[model samples]
Target: MAEMTLHTELPADMTDTRGLPGVQPEHGPWLRVDEAYAAQIARRIALLDDVPEQVLYLETASQGAAQELLHEALNIMPTLGFTVEGAQVTCPDGRKVDVSSTAPLEALGRCLQNDFVMMEKRGDEHVLTGAVLCFPASWSLAEKAGRPLSDIHIPVDEYTENVARRVQRLFDGVQVGRPLWRFNQLWYQDAELHQPRSATAPLRVGSNLPDGPFYRSERQTLLRLPLSRAVIFVVHTYVLARADVPELR
Candidate 1:
């Protein structure tokens, strides 16, 4: 459960929306973006592609930072996929050079391919968000192009931690927990654990150990690799303000 005490004075023009963290909330109190934010959005967008199907996963400690990151993620959606063959990228010295796929992908690995962004609302009100081209595992041409190595679903624990670590980097000082919302299962084939459904009859929330490779427990049920290497993503929010006190009744 989220710590209810953390609620701050809702800034003017800011309202909370339940869906899509990176998306602009159309409806209550929302933080207003200033000229500086506008410039940051422009700079981030110029480095992105022209596509729109990309899926952005956004979560932030502050509302302003969340909004800024959302806009920035949208700006670069078009450049995320294979179509960015000859995009021009601007250098720090104001020099423009045609960007190739390799450099962008490498940049992405090192944190630059519209993969994730951190934005600030006022000064220290920071928010971190991530974006990726949400394509079906089989339908994505990029996945097909890359040679298939192993279909093994990285044990859920390992997979989640990999993503969680990246997520941790976005928010500098928070004890981010990894809580996953697991749904339907895919095919699986392993010698140790084999079954269409997981070993537990009904997977209990907060009780089942992190999903992944097993040690010596009888709790595991499913034994199949995920269809894609990248499966679950972690969204985290952090805050620097003093911890909130209980509401005065």
Candidate 2:
């Protein structure tokens, strides 16, 4: 589990998307990166292959979804200044992304700015079967791969006792064409997106105070794929200076 810092006063409405000041809603959770963040997006995509291979996991069952996700990304990128010319994708910044050489999942992960996880139903549970997690907060992609939703979230304090059953029900009831989103905020000592902890590390519940200079939040969305019957979990991470956060200030 990622180290979390709980606020003294909770937001009036946890589901209020406008609770955070300065952060614009823009296109909502499932975002399309424009020219402004083109450089950063390109840098992260270039670094994807270099990150620990374990950060990406594609099960044999998820191959179709991976391909579908790639197609979906290709169709979505043009609106964000990414144009596909044959097998090459040209970004707004003039960077050419050739996916012909890489695997479908890897190519899709590199092409899009959002981190994606594919969840498939297995018996009574929906498992985290495959994912391309480039910017994990404090959780390890390798540790979470192939685990059921309940098991993956077991480390989250009170998750099992509180939200587990409801979440399972939500996943079971989720249908194609009806996507949902939720936001999660936490204080962190560092701004880096990849913050994997060792198995021996203890889970800290509150902020480390002055040492944690970053206020991190993730906009998470869930949508069911019509063809694959797999749920696509997309996470868009935002890290701001602690001083910049209205609540922290």
Those runs of model 2 whose alpha carbons end farther than 4 Å from true positions after fitting are 1-29, 34-39, 204-211, 247-249
Tell me, by TM-score, which candidate is best: 2
Which number leads on lDDT?
A: 2
Q: Give lDDT tens digits, candidate 1, residues 106-200.
A: 23322221222222222332222223322111122122222221112323343354554443332233222221221222111111111122322
Model 2 over residues 1-249: C-alpha lDDT tens digits? 122222222223332544312122223426446322554455456557577485689898788888887776787677777789877998676767787777777776667667888999999999998888877766778788898988887566646544777778777876776777666677776655566654346744223344667766666778888888888887766656655565432
Predictions in order: lDDT: 0.25, 0.67
TM-score, model 1 to reference: 0.19
Q: Which runs in model 1 stand beyond 4 Å of their true positions? A: 1-50, 55-63, 66-89, 92-114, 117-249
lDDT of 1 at 165: 47
Model 2: which residue pairs collide? none
